[model samples]
Target: MHDFSWGQLVNPEFYIKLGGIYLVLFIIFAETGLFAGFFLPGDSLLFLSGIYSKELIQEIVFIKSDFLNVLLLSSLVSIVGIIGNEVGYWFGKKSGPYLYNRKDTIIFKKRYLFQAKDFYDKHGGGAIILARFLPILRTFAPIIAGIVQMNKGKYFLYNIIGSIAWSFLLIFSGHYLYKIFLNNLDFDLKKHIEIIVLIMVLVTTGPVLFKLFFKKKEGEDDNSI
Candidate 1:
């Protein structure tokens, strides 16, 4: 059996070297669809996938062209992401009423569902797309959409658009940016993967943290008054 380590779980390079493109796709699917997968490294994985697109793609299909490899990798990841969201939506739709009526468990809370509903009410369909860029929100957005019975046609459209945009932008940026730095600036992204991952995490999670902090403070202020 393969030994488990938190270090390996968080390291995108470990994933690439171990399972190559297939593992990357699975992580994207799980992170975007499964409630328990919120903590998985989606953004950094995609970025690193771009950086190592040639190697990852070659593992599955030998391709001499870097552009073709990245393109194929991005397209596959996008499709899997869309499928994952659909699965989350289906789960939420099927279990929506049950979730509302069910008592909160140690792991599940009714208030979270309520908060998702309220967020959807305020943001409408746009939340699906916007949530794609945010970490935890992306995982729950589709599920919430189902619980609230969002328009099926509208949700499907946004699902496709958001998945494609998110996958293509991050993966391509990683691949091309690495090339740019290496050729022009003499900086190698591979040598600085840790810093890159840290920046990606902060950049993606910063807004979520900011809102949570201020929201808590506002609640405290109101309680004091």
Candidate 2:
């Protein structure tokens, strides 16, 4: 087995280098479906998958065209993401009540689950789609859908739409934008991947953090006053 440091675990590039495309698919699966996967790098990993599309795609299949390879990779990732959500929904449906009474552990947090519940309540079925872009919410929204016993057909429809949109948008952005920078601006995303990943994390997780800390605290203060 390959030894992975904590830093390496968090780095999107390390995943690609360590296990290539297959590892990427597993990480996407875990992050989207498992409660313990809430902290995994989702958006940045998808973005980096685009940057390394050629190399990663070669592992599974040989494609002559770069665009087609990225497209194929994105499609595969979308399918895995959809399956992951299905697993999460099934888990929630089976043990929805137990989860509420379960205490927090290193990998599990009641707050994130509650946050997902509120998001689902407010947005109704749309939360499944919207939560695909949000970090913790994305991880738990499907589970919440199952917990509430959302219509199976409706959940499936939103799951497909959300997974496709999320996978295609981020992965394609990385692939095409990398080409644009290299050809036109003489910039290489691969060289500056650290900065790019950092930005992606901040952009994707910023709102969740803001709500968790600032907004929640403000509400507490208001209640106290």
Find the candidate with the highest lDDT and give its number.
Answer: 1
Tens digits of per-residue lDDT for model 1 on 1-225? 277687877778888888888889998999867888898888999999999999888888998888999999999999999999998998889889988899999999989887877777777568888888888888988888999777778788889999999999999999999999999999999999899889998999998899999999999999999
The residue ranges of model 1 lying beyond 4 angstroms of the native Cα positions read 1-4, 103-115
lDDT of each: 0.89, 0.87
Q: Global CA lDDT of candidate 1, please?
A: 0.89
In Å, residue 65's CA in model 1 sits off its true spot by 2.8
Best by TM-score: 1
Candidate 2 backbone collisions, by pair? none
Off by over 4 Å in 2: 1-4, 97-122
Candidate 1: worst 10 consecutive residues by lDDT?
116-125
